[model samples]
Target: MAAVAGIWLYNKGAQHLVSLAAGALLAMALLRLLPEAQEGLVEQGLSHNSLFVFLLIGLVGFFLLEKLSLFRHNHHHEHDGHDHHHGFDKEEAGRGGWMILVGSGVHNFADGLLIAAAFLTDVRLGWLTAVSIGLHEIMHKLSDFSVLLNAGFTRVRALAYTLACGLMAVLGGVLGFYVLSGFESFVPYVLVVSASSFLYIAVADLIPQINAHKGLRAGLTQAAMLLCGVALVWLLSPAHQHSHSHEMEQHEREEPHALMWSRSVL
Candidate 1:
């Protein structure tokens, strides 16, 4: 549904959509993924700084990936005797599209693990986590759809690709349910790596494209759209969970007592 909406919006104005995608990707990486990874690292008694190391490695790895993509594209075009202009060409766009999909898949997979973990702890918490994740997923999917379109993907292909990435969540959930204790330790690192992909795509690809257009009105419009994208994620953030933390704690406290009473009767 989000992808369909993105297709509709793409027909309206793809450039603005790119700006919005940029904002959403950046916010997801910086505002949500990194902080969550940091907290998890701290909980594990590991240095949160290690997250940065993984982040740096991811960025460099993606950079190399893009360079390889560009090289292959240029080589293929050269053999075909076709000349392509520089700056946000088809190759760059395609690279960005693939990178975003990869990042989104990893992020979604992590979300599934988290939701599964929550469910294991408490069903109500699991449902709440799923709801929040669904909302967040919608926002990112819309943004990702736009990027795929901008990368020259046909609407059908873009939708199909996005859905494929979305399915990774189910795979993650299954793995998490079966081996959460062993895998939970790695989720933080996965998040940090996933965040790096978003950061690289937003900064290296999308922002430059947004900056290519010149005009006070265009600049203002782009800025507004970017902020709107960030605002959407902020509004749907899980910060509200903190307010209910005490309630969850109280319920947990009562669970053992209830279990004891039932045992006594038995």
Candidate 2:
């Protein structure tokens, strides 16, 4: 069970492509496709002001996270006892790496809740959220597992630790969905929070990893790659990716689970 969970989380990176596809599907569900399908009544649309509100909330939420030393906090603060260099370079990712395991567990728990909410919205939404989660989790596990390995855990032990952490999503998703469903009157608020969660993870968790490269040239290159990923996601959005989510599903299917040495794709 542990190994299966580890491998499942390890595959999250591969799901990024599919996330783009999911975005495309969502767009179709909103725009050209959805409009035509509606007999007469126009569906509700997202508001820019509301989006701004969500963005503000995400900023504040992450600020609290920063204060609490949660996810992405390590991108700035160094651990007192660990060597951050060559994280898991043929070794555990760092010393006293239990901190990472703990942090990751919390982060994954939040993600599980997000997944549950998405499912409660609808099956399509749930499936999309699951794939997004799967992508996020795989990269997460890869990173956490590497950290454990860097902290002197054997590969097998590291895998075990990561798998234990990975399975937390199931319970989280179910619980979150149930809890959030009771607040259906606050759909817009929920949407805002969900968007904020995505923004927080991308900006908070992933950006720092890109910024930490040693050289100026390397940093610029990484920055470019980051933009490319965003651009690719944008291109595949329903507005451009051919009005369907199949591309994302196909892309996810093609993504590699074992990237050999790292979880850089996340």
Candidate 3:
């Protein structure tokens, strides 16, 4: 659905869509993913600094890949038999489309593991987590499609690649469900890597492209779109699980009674 929508709207307001996506990706990393990574590390009794290190490693690795022309998204079509060339920056964009998919694949796989963890902990919690991830992924996938288009992928190729990358989540979920304890200690680090990928894409990749345009009007419009994107993810964040408050309170209340009952029985 997101791919089709993007293809249909590609002719109109594609740049703004990219800006919105960049903003959302930033929010997903900063507001959501990073915090979750920190909490997971703390839960697993791991040093908090490791999160930062993983993030740095992810960013630098992506930077190096782009430098090597392996992750370049700049596309220039040289026509032979089929002419579909919209010259952007052929050298810079080379192979970038595949790079984005690879990054997204890693992130989605982590998402599957996280969702599986939530389900193992509690079914209700798992459902809530799944819904949250679904909403965020819709926006994330849309932005990915926009970035691919900017990198010069045809509509067909972009959609196919995006869908293919999305399947990694399924694989992760299966692994997570069957082997939860084995992966439990490692989930936090995976999340950190995911956050790093999003930060690198939003900051190092997408921002430069959008920053080239000058003019107060364009600036203000971009700012608004960016905020809107952040707002979308922020609104959908796990922090808004107020509906679980009653359940949590009830659990707390039961703990003392359960303890007393156990003691009396003994």
Top-TM-score structure, candidate number: 3
lDDT of candidate 1 over 1-266, digit per residue (tens): 44455445544776777777777767767877778778888899989688888889989987886675531111211222223345648987788778778877876776677667655544544554455455435545766776677778897898999888788888988888778656777767666765776688678767876898999999999999899777765665555455467789999999999999999999
Q: Which candidate ranks first by lDDT, i.e. highest?
A: 1
Candidate 3: the clashing residue pairs are 72-93, 72-96, 73-93, 74-93
Q: Model 3: residues >4 Å from true position, as ranges?
A: 68-70, 73-181, 243-266
Going through the candidates in order, what is the number of backbone clashes in each? 0, 13, 4
**Looking at model 2, which ten-residue stretch has the lowest summed lDDT?**
33-42
- The collision pairs in model 1 are none
Off by over 4 Å in 1: 1-3, 70-182, 240-266
User: How do all models score by TM-score?
Assistant: 0.57, 0.57, 0.61
Better of 1 and 3 by TM-score: 3
lDDT of 2 by residue, 22-89 (tens): 33333323332223222111234554444465558766987797677676533323432335454334
- Over 6-118, each residue of candidate 3 has an lDDT whose tens digit, in order, gives 44564476567667767777876787667777888878777889778888897898678667745443322211122335665655554655667787788678778877766
